[model samples]
Structures are given as C-alpha cells and as structure tokens.
Target chain A: MTDTQNSRDAVVIERTFDAPVVLIWRMWTEPEFLKEWYGPDGASIPIANMDVRVGGIRRVCMEMPSPNGPMQMWFTGEYREVVEHQRLVYTESVSAESGPVLSPTSPGTAGGHPMMTEVRVELEAVGNRTKMVMTHAGVPSDSPGAAGWAMALDKLAANIATNRGR
Target chain B: MTTAIDEDRLTETFAALANSTRRAILARLAEGGATVNELAEPFTLTLPAISKHIKVLERAGLVVRGQRAQYRPCVLDATPLEAVSTWADRYRPVWEARFDRMDDYLRQLRRQEGASEADD
Candidate 1:
C-alpha cells in the first residue's frame, strides 16, 4: 500500500547547561567535541562527514553492540537550516553501506529509505545556562523504523551524558 | 498503574507499530473508536485478517477493544506510543550533538585540505 499519510509528530528534549551558549554550540558544531559524546553507551561513531550549510549533506556511520549481534547503519541527509549558534534542522534516512535502506517508508533516501525522520534542534541562552530543545518528526506512527530510531536515540543520550571528553 | 516498564515491553510495542497497516489502524482509532467492520472497510483485507491484526495490536496493549452491540470497538491506548516517545527522547541530543560536531570537523578538514592544496 502506498502510505502517503503525513503526521507532524515531534520529540522535544530540553537541557539547561551550566555553560555558555558558545561552549554548548561548540560541543554541537565541533567534531572533536562530538566524538566525546554521540551514540549509545557501548556504541561509537567512527565515521562522520558533514557540511552544515543549507542543502549540504551530513553523513555518519554508526556502529553499536547489540545482543543479537553487532550492527551498523549509515545516516545520511541534507541540512535544511543552519544558524551559526542557535538552531539547526536536518532530515535523515537510514541505509546500509552496500545495500538499500531497510526502512520501507523512506526509499532511495541515502541508501534504504525504509524510514525517514526529520530533526530540529534549537539552543536558547537563558542567562549563564543554555537550554537546548530537539525535535524529531516524520517518524511513522507504526513503523519499526521509528522504534529503531528510538533505540538509537536512547543510546545516543547516554552517550552524551557520559561524555567525559567535552 | 504508572509502574516502571521493561525493555521487552518497549520492544514489543515498537515491533507492533512497525507495520504501516497497524499505524493506519491506530490513526483510524485515534479519530475515535471503530468496530472491526468499520476498520476493515478501508482496506482490501478479509475480516479475519483484520481481526488478526487487531489481535497483534491488542496484545501490544495499544488498543482496548470492547464489544458493544455486536461490534468490537477499538479505543486508542497511547501508553505504548508514549513509551516509544520516551525512548526517542533519550537520544535526541546525542544525535544532534554528533551532527553538529560532524559538520565542524568536515568544515575543518575541508579547510585544511584546501590550504594544503593552495600551498602546493
């Protein structure tokens, strides 16, 4: 069935940091700082290529240890918006290295557009604290891809909180 | 009961939602409760097939089907979807952070590469 259904579902996470907006922005926009925190607890992102301009592409390969086994997924998409130190928006579709995306909803998307999800992140400076809010949309309400994305996000969060490098 | 949930429940709930058909069914029910016949009307599948699908959804506790006047009306049980949202909420920052860092690294690499080429 051709699922043309569109739902504006979003996931928002707000974090108030004890640091300045510039430092927080650096953690987000700098690769060196990113490597310190960007994945689940056990998983690591060894490959990342990005261009933060409008219409530019951001690509990364993620590897994680799963109970079923170790797995990898390539997240590739284009930048929709980039504001120097305030906000960024991008859309991503997951695909495999040498194969089509496993998600059925997103096809021809970088690899296998099995599932397509849009992400928006906003950083608000409140005094010396920085409040960051992130929204993830376009996840099909019932697609397994959403679930996978959810799992990946969980690991991604732990990866960030425990990041000792930055 | 607002008890802490397990990973298995989360996984089951997400797996149940992986199908577009199931999502459609959920969306339909979200508009309001609907009977098996009403739900199946939109699809070309057989009544028993839709029933089976409902069973999967029911097992996931995403919907609470009630029998009313010869109709099995399904109500949306957003609990599981909430779980899914919670799971996604945990990692949104990590990915955003990664993307941000990646962008900077690539720009830096590109700049260095350009400068080297200029020197050559």
Candidate 2:
C-alpha cells in the first residue's frame, strides 16, 4: 500500500525497502548509517548523536549549501518510546548547538510551527523486505529564525532552571 | 529559514486558540458576525465570560468588533487562519525528500551486500 492517506496537521509516510527489518532499524538507530541518508538532497549531516533508548537523547546537525552561504541546522529530541525494531517515538524540537531542550509550550521559530513536535516510526518485516511507517505530527521544523529563538530560550531555560531547578 | 511570520503573533494566535470556549466562539462567529449577547446565547456562560473569550479573539486579530456604531458585531478576520494555512503543508515534503534519500541509500546497501556475497 502506498502512503496515500495523510492529514495536514500530521504527516505520515509509508515505504517498503529491500533491506531486512534489522538493517533498516540499524540505519535509524545508528548515527553512522543515519548520517548517510538523513536530510534533504545536497545536505550533509555533520552531527548525529543518537542514544536510541527510552529517554535517550538525539542531537543532529545538518548542513546545506545555499546561495548566501552554507547553513547549519540543529535539532534535538528525546526518545520517549523505543520498542527495539518494531517502534520508536520521540519528541523533536528546534535546538541550539549547545543543546537546550525547550518546553512544548515554548514559542517556535519562523513559520509559526510548534517549538517541539513528535515523530513516530514503526517498522515491520515482510519476508526479506522492511515496511516502514513514519509519522511526524506538528509544524515542519525549519526556518532561519530557529537560531535566535533557540539561543533566547537557551538563556531562558538556564535562568529558569536556576530558579526552579527543573 | 526565516520568513515573514512573526513569532510572537503566531504564539499569541495559538494561545488564543488553545481554549474550547474560544474555539466554539470562533465556530459560532464563522457563520456570521454576532453581538456579544447573541454570541453568549448558545452557552450557559455569563455575558462577561463570553465577552472575555471575544476579547482574546479580538487581541489575536481573529475577531474585529465594529466601532463608533451602536450595533457592534464581532467579525472573523481569518487572516491569521490564512497564515496558518499557508505554512501548514510544509512539513510533509521535507520528510518526503529525506525518505527519498533513504530509499536510495537502502538500494546502495543492498548492492554492497550483493557484492560481498559474490566475493565470498
């Protein structure tokens, strides 16, 4: 079945790959494999620090060539659910290179997307092939305003943690 | 990267929308403009309570009340909603592109495995 049904608020993509389920899972969980195929065309992932467990941290930075210059994008998330090769759920957020986690309620970067969003991935083995379903719910994570908002929130989080210790 | 979307205004718009009462009010307003009393008629909520909802919508630029007129009606501006619509569909394509790259990489991996098996 094709990934033909999806709504605007949440995006769902389904694909079948020739690789076995274990290798597909490794491609996602392992940073080395992830760097080889994560990001848009012509974009390079210089950083892919993934701890691939429940409550583990995931930090990724992707760099792309632009008319003005090469731009780097940073994002961080925590793995909320990890069911080995079958499923994974994580909360993705635009983050600073310093890697401060922003609250879901925190304002987003440009385009008015949510500061934090959730991504769910499910994998199934079909004979020797792997079927993967990925769902990303919330605003698309991009826009140049991310750096400013991330830095401001980084300081805000520091000061707030200083006071609340949360 | 950065476009013209205002971060604060967008936050305010969502915050303004984060209430059931306000959402109901918007749904009611969508039919047409209504006076404060008329808008309050559907709910058991008091006039002031409904008025507070209207104020929030008004502040978010979703509702515009007529001024200098005896019969002021709350009008739905819909511009912010329009802004929301403009950016809503962007997330899907980004992931689609990455998945395209993934498909290519998976093919390459299969090729390498086939090569190694041949060597053996």
DockQ of each: 0.12, 0.15
lDDT of model 1 at position B64? 97
TM-score for model 2?
0.74
Model 2 CA lDDT for position B35 = 91
**In order, what is each prediction's RMSD in angstroms?**
12.5, 11.5
Off by over 4 Å in 2: A1-6, A95-114, A139-166, B1-13, B46-48, B70-72, B82-88
How much is the lDDT of residue A12 in candidate 1? 56
Give the Å error, residue A34, model 1: 1.3
Cα-based lDDT for every prediction: 0.63, 0.68
* lDDT (Cα, tens digit) per residue for candidate 1, span A32-119: 6655566656767787777778887777777777686767767767678999779888776555444454332332232212445567
Q: Candidate 2 overall Cα lDDT vs. reference?
A: 0.68
lDDT agreement of model 1 with the native: 0.63
> How close is every model to the real structure, measured as TM-score?
0.48, 0.74
Q: For candidate 2, lDDT tens digit of each residue in B1-120?
A: 322234345556656666667767776666678898889998999988998999999998989999848768887776775444333366667778778888898888879989999999
